[model samples]
Target: MMGALGQSFINGITIGSSYALVAVGFTLIFGVLRVVYLSHAAVLAACAYIGYGVIEVTNSAVAAIVVATLAGAVLGVVIERIAIRPVRGQNHLIPMVTSISVAIIIEETLRLTVLSGQPISYPDTFASTVIRLHVGGAEPYFTVGQVLIFALTLALVLTLRVVVQRTWVGRAMRAVADSEDVSSLLGVRVNVTSARTMALASMLAGAAGVLLALSIGAIDAHFAEPLQFKALAIVLFAGLGSIPGAVVGGYLLGFVEAFAAGYLDTSYRDLFAYVLMIAILMMRPQGLFGRRLTQRV
Candidate 1:
């Protein structure tokens, strides 16, 4: 029982780390633009396919990841320029509706053309090897892919923290998030900041999509939908714009999923996630780290 528990814990952490990556992207766009980017999942799926193509040509996972990241970043900028920018400052629902339309177009395009509405096997990489670790009386085993996911997630989160808190672009992003008009008055390039925010968010989503596909060994156009929803829940759980909260909420949700699947049924894993989200909202509507809202009469 202990062994099984330990294994589930490890698996949960791995899965949750991926969730964190996606959630962070969601948080970034929301913080900067205040628009719910419904197209992010489509972006993730599109990038995964792009990664697959890169692997087919170069046969290098590293190359695939690099190309996919760049593609996602470019796509992010394009989406912002074409779809989002036009709707900016409109009713909040306008951008959201636009994003949904864009997501549908992208998904259908992939399904009809490249993906053909079928799942594609990810290129085999570190997934082929399993590393066993012995600690005291507990021997837990993990795949190279899982280890890579965890390590990369840690590094990415740390780097994101530094970028958001210390860098000039990060400062610009925060300023824009606070007040776009004020930031522009203060000489911050609002357009450039928005573009960079989208790029960074999309890159993170792209990396998560590729790594997650590699971990699972297969991906389809629909694969990112559930992940997108989970990312939303995680972002809310972590606090809307709090990067660290996103990370922690991601791992917490992961553990919930892993333990639930391990001890119960896999079908209930998503249910558990929703239930947890509801419970958290009921207990703390502002999220674990979010600030309470105030309005002047």
Candidate 2:
């Protein structure tokens, strides 16, 4: 039983790390822009397809990931400049509605383009099974990829902390998050900062897309929907604008879903995500790391 639990814990971390990456991206965008960016998932899925094409041509996973990241970054820049910029300073709902429309368009384009009712597979390089750490004295070993996922997650968390706390760009981003008006007054180039934030968020999404495609070994348009909701849940639960919160929230949600599948009904795994979201909202509306809202009467 102890061994079983250990293995399960490892599995949870592996899945949770991916969740954390997605959540981080969501939170980054929210921090600087205050936009929900519902289309981020479409960007992820579209990049994965682009990665798939790269793999097909070069027969290399690394090459494919590079191409995908560049494609995703460019897409993010275009979307922010074209689709999102027009609605800037309008009611928040206007941008959100625009994002939803863009998401639909992206999905439809994906369905009609590279992902026409078929699953795209990456090269065999991603198919090799790596050995994960041993647990339970002798049984049920996890794979290397799972271990990599957890390690990569830790690395990402550390990188984010260092970036935010140490870099000039990080300070500008924080300044914007704290108060865009003040940031602009300080000559921080608010527009540039916002654009960079969007690009950075999309880059993270691109990396997550690569890992996700590798883990699943397949890519399709429909697969993006669940990840989209999952990422949103993580960001919401982690508290808007809090990077560490996003990490913690992602891991928590991932573990809950995994354990639910193990102990409760397998079908209840996803249902539990929403249940937890609702419970958190009812009990603590601000979320785990979210700040309390203040309003003037």
Candidate 3:
């Protein structure tokens, strides 16, 4: 029993790391743009497919990752300029609706063009590699894919922390998040800052998408839908705009799902996340790290 539990814990952490990547991107976009950016899932899928294509040509995972990240960043800029910028500061519902429409368009386009609504297997880069770790009397193992996910996630998270805490663009992003109007008045280029934020967030999402495809060994057109919901739950669980909260919430959700699947029913794994989400919403709507705002007249 202890052996099984240890194995499950390892699996949970590996999966949770991927969720943390997606959730962090979700929170970053929300913090900067104040929009849900529902098309994030679509962007993820698109980048994954792009990565797959690059791998097919170059057979280099590194090249695929770089190309996909760039593609996602460019897509983010396009989405912002074409779909989001025009709707900025309008009724919040407008941007939300536009994002949904954009998501649908991206999904459908992928379905009709390259993906054909089918599952495409990723190249067998690390599928056969496994690291065996002996912990006590139990032997818990991790796949090379899982190890890469964990390492990349850690690196990305630390890089993001540095960017947010130590860079000029990061400062601009924080200022814009505080108040776009005030930031602009203070000579901050609000448009440029927003664009930079979107690029960074989308690049993260792209990396996540590629990692997910590598982990699962396949890319499916509809793969992003459930992930999108999971990411949303993580964001809400952590607090809408808190980066640290998103990471913690993501791991929490991943562990809950992993445990539920390993010990309970696999079919009910997704239920745990929604249940936790509801519990958090009811108990502390502001989220674990969220601060309640006091409006003044």
Candidate 4:
């Protein structure tokens, strides 16, 4: 029984770390730009496919990740330019609709081309190699890739914190987030800040895709779309635009899912976080880490 519990804990952390990565990306964009970015899942899926292609050609996961990160950053800029920037200052819903349109276009393009409208196996994820020291068991507690995911998530998220809190670019971003018009008038480059913010967020998004692809070992054109909702739930529950809260919520969701699947019906796992999210909203509308913002209509 103790062994089972320990294993479940491990499972939760592994799964949750990936969720945190995805949620952080979503939260950053919303926190900085106030854009829901409906096309995030499309970008993730596209980056995964791009990573897969790189793996096939170079037989190196590192190369795949690099290529996918660049691809994701570029895509983020493109979407910001086309779907977000043009719709800036318009009704928020308009940009959401435009983002959805961009998402649909990207998904369809991948479906017809690289994806071939079907699910495909992720090549050589290296899931079996144990990287941790043995703890008197034949098998190690965690695999190399899982450890890497955890370490990489920690590093990337910490780096994001430093970037946002310690850097001049981050200052511009926060200023824009506070008030774009004011920031622009104050000589802050609003466009550049927003573009840089999206690129940073998209890099995390792309990394999440590749990491999850490695864990799940399979990908379909639309598989990531459902996960986007999961990430969104984490973001909402953690707090609107609360990156750290989202990270914690991601791990919480992972634990919930791990235990739900372990001791209860598997189907209910997906519903658990959402139900909890609604409950949290009812009790604390500002979310676990979000502050209530007052705006004049």
Per-model TM values vs. the true structure: 0.95, 0.90, 0.94, 0.93
Model 3: per-residue lDDT, tens digit, 1-297?
677787778778877888898899889988988987788898999999999999888887778778988998998888888778888888888988998898899988998887468789898765437778787787778787787778888888879878987998899899988999999999999888878888888888888888888888888777978888888888987898888998888888889888888888889898887898889888888998898878999
Off by over 4 Å in 4: 125-141, 293-297
Local distance difference test values of all predictions, in order:
0.88, 0.78, 0.85, 0.84
lDDT for 90 (candidate 1): 82
Worst 10 residues of 1 by lDDT: 122-131
Candidate 4 global CA lDDT score: 0.84
- Lowest lDDT sum, 10 consecutive residues, model 4, at 131-140
Q: Is candidate 2 or candidate 3 better by TM-score?
A: 3
lDDT of 1: 0.88
Per-residue lDDT of candidate 4, residues 1-297 (tens digit): 454556567778888998898899888888888877788899999999998898888877778777888889999999999999988878889988999999999989989987468888988755436554434453336675676678889989999999999999989988988999999999999888888988998898788777778777889778788788888888987898887899889998999887777667689887876787788889888888989879999
| Model 3, position 163: C-alpha lDDT score | 97
By lDDT, the best candidate is 1
Better model by TM-score: candidate 2 vs candidate 4: 4
Ranking by lDDT: 1, 3, 4, 2
Per-residue lDDT of 20 in model 3:
92
Residue 177 local lDDT, model 4: 85
Worst 10 residues of 3 by lDDT: 124-133
